[model samples]
Target: MENLPKGSPKLINAWAFYDWANSVYSLVIATAVFPIYYESVTSSNGGMVDFLGITLPNSSLLSYSLSFSFLIVAFLSPILSGIADYSGNKKSFMKFFCYLGSLSVISLFFFRDTNTLWIGILATILASVGFWGSIVFYNSYLPEIAFPEQHDRVSAKGFMFGYTGSVLLLAFNLTMIMKPEWYGIMDETLPARISFLMVGIWWMGFAQYTFHYLPSNVYNRKPRKDFIFKGVKELKEVLIGLKKLTTLKQFLIAFFLYSIGVQTIILLAGIYGKVELGIETSQLIITILLIQIVAIFGAFLFSRISERIGNIKTLKLTIAIWGFICFAAYLLDKDNKYIDIQFYALGGVIGMVLGAIQSLSRSTYSKLLPETEDHTTYFSFFDVTEKIAIVLGTFIFGFVGSITNSMRNSIFILAIFFLLGYIVLSFMKKIEPVK
Candidate 1:
């Protein structure tokens, strides 16, 4: 491993390209196709899913499964990231997760019947874990790959690639699934199943470009035979160090608060539209595509804004808008004549802030990390924070929807989380470039 130049465009683009490779899982499996497919399948099968030998509302079951998977990853990331850093094999670890995730996605093609419902839920959980687990190591590379000053723009570039790449694939998938007759396919399920297979191949195939270029071990550390226990020691050291890093600590708190709302919205938005609001499958797909398209501009636009107004201020603005989105969501009702139009309007606002918040959050946290070779350990903490937030958010969203039998109240409840996040951000100091 050599000390690579900080601003090498080739290396940076290689790093960004991984986003292109992996984001199909996000758009297709997590956000767009699978959730809608899951809902449609479950709804047709008596609206009750058999999970762990118990029958439950399909929506609640899916939400709880997601919450459970994220919880497992959040607990494991710190230790696993510690080992990757110690062994100087973060890339290997990342690849392992990618394989796990992509393969799990491909396996979903087998999940077509009510009796196979467990396979869908189990596969979804593993796929999510694989995707998110890789992200911990992937994010750790930011501080090593780019100078702190370049963090915002570089992060935005990665997200922009992600949006564009996922949109391209998703649009193709949409055409095949939504209008099967146009493709001369009488079975709608066949195309959707094929989309799953395509996502796995796309994820693993494009990732080769990233793997070809990214350095295997930039620091080139040689771990001792006791590396496993030493990894735990490294993780403990990072935990102790974080207690004294007041600025980073505060930002993590704020991030956790906002993520509760933001992540829940992303994971559940399609399902919410389909089941609760009675939005057509075609309309939902179009709305998600609109988000991906608009998000490219949003990522670049907010990157510049952050440069001009500062990261903290930029983030504050985004969080406030997220709160407003929640409030607006509360007002949407199926009885309204312009319900579809209102939903699209919500999608527009979601797009405007979605990429901005994600890119900015990653860069801001990267900038805040202390000077150390334990990049993976630090980032694991960041990843864990958001993962736990997702757990809490999904659990509460599902719980509320279950008890009340309405998703609107769950949407309204999420608004307070964004408000709390905004208030916490007010106390965070401006970020200084890491020397």
Candidate 2:
């Protein structure tokens, strides 16, 4: 592999483009636009509360749904990943899931007013599952394309490009919102739906570059005739791998716990701003824009910091920053005059830490794996833990907010997760990369 040029510009560009492609889902559908639209369409005339089976508000229900969806994915992703690995069809599985997610996101266009709340919710669930399932294979491809030495740089580059792509589309979508009259869209809702469609189109269009440039690894063995049974066998092996994780049990436990907090923060940031702080929808979009813009520079900055302090130390620093951010969020008041300032500060802090935490974690985990043949199985475990974290964090936050009627108070509890993670991370000795 070294005899071949490390990675060509085209290969790198193609790799980064996938990040650009899928980030539309993250920026528009997951974080900024869709949640606001969902709340608006689903809420009562009061414009804040929703009517689920119980009398829960839209914000609370959305949080609960997000958490529930993550829990479902946590149980299922390992099984899917095992199937993909046993079939030697990771790319095929990625493409199938991408289409499923994209189609589900586009289906959001049909959900109008409060009439089809269940339809909207179902679409969201399917899209969320597709988005997450595709990422399992997407992330598994990292080691295949780049050698160990280039992993951090390549991962950093992919994240930076993702932020850039999301920001670009966001800038366009924001313009459409700011000047809806110019686009001849009668209602605000139409344009938002159009924006969702745009994400699907953009994802499908740009993804072709990666599909064309990134060659699949050659497997000399013929696929098993009874692929279903083969998948089952592989899944059994995956369970055995999970059992072996007991050797690094402490680190795994800490990662699982802290990730819940991190996932909650990412999933609920937009809702928290709009619902808790009463920030305008436009302002929420702008705040996300700020995060993406700053995140590009932050990625580079944190990369340098990781070089100096080591990835583990850098991650600990981020955890400390996250704790402070959570405390500050909890302190916000209903008046909301300082809401924008708080969001901007949070965005900046997150931008600085986000890249470091993700890249370092991936690099660190890659070093600790038992073998290359088990990469898909091990990474599937990683994906499951990630979903589990999201499930716990989102569930706890949503459950607490619903019971107490205070999003701010719920946010304060998140600090404990970060603090605990930081403490555990400090005791961990970094593993050397396996040759």
Best by TM-score: 1
Regions of candidate 1 where Cα sits further than 4 Å from its true position: 1-4, 402-405
Candidate 2's TM-score reads 0.90
In order, the Cα lDDT scores of the candidates are 0.90, 0.75
Residue-level lDDT of model 2, residues 237-300, one tens digit each, is 8677667664345567777777877778877877788788887777777778887887787777
Off by over 4 Å in 2: 1-9, 45-57, 245-249, 333-339, 402-405
- TM-score each candidate: 0.95, 0.90
Error of 1 at 404 (Å): 4.6
| Each prediction's RMSD to truth | 1.9, 3.0
In candidate 1, what are the lDDT values of residues 3-34, reduced to their tens digit?
44767898899999999999999999888888
Residue pairs in steric clash, candidate 1?
Answer: none
Best-matching candidate per lDDT: 1
